[model samples]
Target chain A: MEKSLVINPDKCTGCLQCEMACSYENEGVFNPAKSRIKVFTFHQEGRFVPYTCTQCSEAWCQQACPVDAISLNLVTGAKEVNESSCVGCKVCTISCPFGTINYNQSSGKVIKCDLCGGDPKCASACPTQAITYVDADQTGLDKMRQWATQTDNATSNTASNA
Target chain B: MHYIIIGAGPSGVIASENIRKLDQNAQITLIKGHKEPPYSRMAIPYFLEEKITEDGTHIRHKSNSFNEQGITLVNELVSEVKTKDNTLVLSDGSELVYDKLLVSTGAIATSPPIEGINSNHVYNCWTLEDARNIAKKAIPGSSLVLMGAGFIGCIILESLLKRGVNLTVVEMGDRMVPRMMDESAGGLLKSWCESKGVRILTSEQVISISEAKAKPLQVNLKNSDPLSADLVICATGVKSNTGFLESSDIKLDQGILVNEFLQTNIENVYASGDVAQGLDFSDQSWSIQAIQPTAVEHGRIAAINMVENNSCVHHGSINMNILDTMGLISTSFGQWMGVEGGEESVLLDEQNFRYLNLQFKGEHLVGISSLGHTQHIGVVRGLIRGKVKLGVWKERLMNDPTRLMEAYIANI
Candidate 1:
């Protein structure tokens, strides 16, 4: 099964360590502007959403890319930009529904979260477990188990059709 | 099989790589018009701003990437193509033959005809050579006069501002990026730049430029006072580099003519990138969408047809341009200039520098131009490109365009 980055925005602290780790891992820099993953702070609601590419199965970015620069990683299920193939057109950046893919002015290329080539640095760098790299097929397993534990096992509330 | 790809720009290089992947035993030779190692022209601004090194402008970082993949890199210009002989005649008096050919020569920066415009201080920021020359003199406190404020000019303007130069942008058009953005949108950008301390002169013409030995040159404008500047950069526009093809049998219209398959009139000969006049999906028109993404799409579509024996067909391309001027983001998509008999909706907030304009034909959204509101940039394009039926959402959008995300989710 392909691995994926499962994000729980509620656990996010907005410390921005993930942003630093991402930029350093991919761009060899500590600049937050260069980070593929971004943390959006909703000041009024006191909430923070750490967002990046969701690696959609039918990704519009991969389909809309003119040069086919975006490709699906079989192991990580992350969409990777072949920098050499990308023309810095910003089409894929605009095509993505999440707006996670962004154009890097320094490199003149669009960048998105590539899950750090299977071992994502953002997940390891997160102190609050807000971002986790896990098996994609079982991402809902934990939620299903939680709901299962809350069920009233001893009560049968079914109506009989006599 | 042998493949001869002309022009080492993104389109040609990507096509060559894709072709090689499909057919490993095929002989591939990529001919570049310049000496650079497949560097991106888009990265030149970053190089000018000192954000990236010269090496960083190169698309591939690996050493001898082409050679390792058995793709020959020929740094030479194709002076002529003998279609009947199935061969290419290079400028160095060499002949190369191939089973398939791709022309992706891209474009050349156009210099307006003016007196002493070719002086030492004048430059065109379209190539690596131009970037290197401008970076040396675009220093802090240096006075620079930039001609034209179109797409390329606006991008270079941002870099020049970062260099701390006293920049003056003179545009012949009434507003900046006249071709890309509408009047109000371009006007807003001009004000935004002016607030950032850059001087903008619109609806103006540069009469003449007199060269100087080592001092500042005199730049005379038609409707303004004469000014002296340390350097003058021309960002007038670009034309397709299809001059060599003038003698060839290929059909040309502003650019080389290609069908939906991206094939030229001649069989086994294809064209992509800025040099090809492909389809515009917005209205099924034939035009040169010279932007980088269009070039990439043309390259991939052409490569698929070449490898699959003309089995693949292109669905056409949408004209899209996204510009980040200083910190402000502006975008235009599809028929942004508006189609005939189309209903239009606009929302402008000059104080906040936020604007959105949507064009509609019946229930389908056709064109969009926006500035500052970038949260859901994809929805407009998706709805327009997908040609999704809006239904009641159209009425809701006509009321307020900010509900684009809600519309996209409900429709798609």
Candidate 2:
């Protein structure tokens, strides 16, 4: 199975280290604005959601790209934007549900998280473990395991009553 | 086979690349009018904002990319083409012969006729040279006045804002992006930009600009008071570079007319990008689609037919445009402007500033326009391009247009 970048928003501290690392990794710059992965802050709710491209199965950005500028990486499961092919139309930026794919005006191309060509810098740079790269099929395993633990307690109570 | 491509813009470059890909031994020559590398005109705004260096605008990143692919790059402006002889005369007193020719000279920004419009401070954000001039003068806090509020103007607005200019936009139309959006959508966008601290003047025209020495130029408006600005940008519009072909025997109507195969009237000669008036998918009519996607598609199809003897056929180009202004997103696809006798469904949320307009010609969606609704926007393009049979979902969509995602899922 291909690997995916799993984001845990609850653990996000909004330190923006992942953004810095991501920009540095991909662009050789430390500017957060250049980073593909973004962290959204809900000040009133006191929540920070670190978000990036999910490398969606359907991949609207890939489909909407008229020139086939976007392609799927089989190994990483990341929707990669081919800079050579991209024409900076900004259509994919609109098609992206999460708005993860963006037009880079400087390069005249659409840019998104490519999972660092298989090794995501955002996952490693995250200090709070807010982001991690794991098996795509098992992305829901952690949540499933949490619910399974609650079932165990319920089962014990019924056994004791019997 | 010697293949010559005029205009080293995205279309010409892409076509040349494809031609070389199809036949490795073929002689490919790219004629660029400018001295710099082939760059996208869309990147000029970002360049003005200093978001990227000039070199970043290059379509190809690798050094000597053309030479690496064995494509010869010539720097010369093509003055004339002899279709019968399949030869072109360059401005530098040189002639080149080609077996097949692709004219993709693109377009030039139109400078509105106004007094002092040619002043040193006045600029158009069209080419890399124009971007350089604007960047050099558009210093932080410098007073800048933009002359148009169409799609291109709005795009440049964001970059100018990021540069911290005391920006003001003057539009002759009632609302911004008058060509792309309806009143409600354009109005919401105007308000959104106003909230973001952009001064907008609608239904106004710049009567004239007075040249001054060592002082801000005076900008006289049709309705409002005169304003002073250090720089004036003319985002008015663009005209195709077909003026050069007036002497040629090839057909011209606003732009170089091309058939569905992107072939011009003359045999073995073609045009693409802003220079070509290609077919519109919504209606079987020819129109100039100056957008980048259409240009790229035109280039690919033109190249394939040029090299492989009709290996590919171009159906038509969908009129599509998406603009991001100061973080506000707006999109228009196909015939965003409703056709005659078309049934329309509109969902307008004025409070939240979200709007959706869908135009249906019978069971198929011919056009769609939206604001602030980013998710699944591409589905509209899919539905329109695929011409999917919506069946009962068409009626359901007419009742509730927000079920677009559902309809797309069930149909496409």
Candidate 3:
């Protein structure tokens, strides 16, 4: 029962609705800063990339979180942050490579993505299927086809040249 | 399959009704993460100034009307999304499985990285809760320190100044809303703000903030200086809520990237609202502006594409601005600032405060910005969005704005 969000940067228009959904789901308000999932805009490249806690089987934010504020939810396979236990020290914020976990200064708590338990708000709010909650194991299917298209281009280019 | 939509904001509620209209047999359940019904985010500054009440800012007509249409309104949060089994785990431990899913999760305020930003007086006005808290503490003649003098900052200053809030707006940038207006307009706006007693600090970066008990928040400046204020607010910007999304297979970048169809890589998942950055008509790019109109439009477009795919959806291809502050009403659509094609013609009467600036690329109207005039505003928007030629309106645009549209429609 592994659940994960599949993000396609090509389709992403970078609206921040996913971030809004994540924050509203966990924080009881429509706040993007409080959202566990983060969307980063690559302005120079004319692209938008939304990233969140990948909820890796080997979670760094979870292990780095002091007082065990972050824990893996078995039902949805999401690493959730317990605000009451979170000290807002931002230890996990530093320890995680992606920097998904953040400290809420107002609430004096640490927040990260919890997969909305399992029905992620980001995936729901996305007007484009840029972000989707899908089978973790089969996430690479799109990439496989994408590369496969690239692979076919070689023969087509060679044929056109001939 | 019963549909449960969460966070009855503009995105969630509109999505519900659109879904119902498309597939009437589908049972819908809408959940609100907050106590109040969905409201417009853009009208907030006006509401705070007593120009309009909370109802005046509502994006939804009759929120409770959803229940009459056989939609369940759940006043709670959806604790989890169990993607493996395809079910929603609510705060009450309730679960809902849907045939399709739409996430209208909006954005949050990103508090700037300043010193002592957690003081009791520091605030960010992105939520009803934040607004209420700031309002409770906002008193006449209360000194205010606002970080990031962007569009929101200027509007907030204009609105709050009328009510006697001693305000000082600090921006890291050299000009205000550099993305929207050109350098000249910014200089004019800077003078306007200063004339209104709104202290403007440009090219000044707030390093950190010290304690604010008896004195104002001691803001350590980029230079070896410090400013003090009783209340400090960070309007720097915001980041998206893609946290729990890590576990899911949703593709994300500045936001969840959906295609023209507004469908995620996954089978039945869709994203919209502030968090979803679609297309930018202004720069022919992809960026998300945390404006309330874009959120509602994104939700509507996404919901339509979700159920039916008859029409194409564009994350706007141009950058646009339409705002009215005090007696000033101005709008600029498309790239009017420094694009090479347009020849600039401005009618500026400082004494009368009747300013109309038009930049023309050949005979068509490329961009327009004005003060004390309300004609050709919608016509410009329609032209920019439609890329229609302004053969008829060009001769009489500077003369009159209201009739400009009629003439253009007839000629074209």
Q: Which is the leading candidate under DockQ?
A: 1
lDDT of 3 by residue, B1-412 (tens): 6666655676666667666766678878777767676665555775667655666555444556767778777776666666667677777787778766777666767876556778777888777667666676667887778888776676677567766778888888898766666666666667777876788898888888887456667877885467777777788887765564666667888877766556777667777666676666546466666554355455556666656652435536344554444435445556666467566667766654456677666666666665445432434544554455667456666465444444333332
Candidate 1 lDDT over B297-365, as tens digits, reads 677677777877776666677788887787677888888888888888899999989888888999988
Q: In candidate 1, which residue ranges exceed 4 Å CA deviation?
A: A4-74, A80-91, A95-100, A103-162, B212-214
Candidate 1 at A33: error in angstroms?
Answer: 14
Model 2, runs deviating above 4 Å: A1-79, A82-89, A93-162
Better of 1 and 3 by lDDT: 1
What are the runs in model 3 whose C-alpha is more than 4 Å off? A1-162, B61-63, B77-84, B89-94, B282-284, B309-312, B315-318, B338-344, B349-366, B392-407, B410-412
How do the residues B89-179 of candidate 2 rate in per-residue lDDT, one tens digit apiece? 9999899999999999999999889888998789988888888888888888899999999988998887888788898999999999987
DockQ for all models: 0.10, 0.06, 0.01
DockQ (model 2, Cα): 0.06
What is each predicted model's overall lDDT from 0 to 1? Answer: 0.80, 0.80, 0.63
lDDT string for model 3 (A94-152, tens) is 33324456556566456667777788889999999999988877785443223222221
Give the per-residue Cα lDDT of candidate 2 at A150: 29
lDDT of 1: 0.80
Superposed on all Cα atoms, the candidates' RMSDs to the truth, in angstroms, are 9.7, 11.6, 21.2
The global Cα lDDT (0 to 1) of model 2 is 0.80
Each candidate's B-chain TM-score, in sequence, is: 0.97, 0.97, 0.87
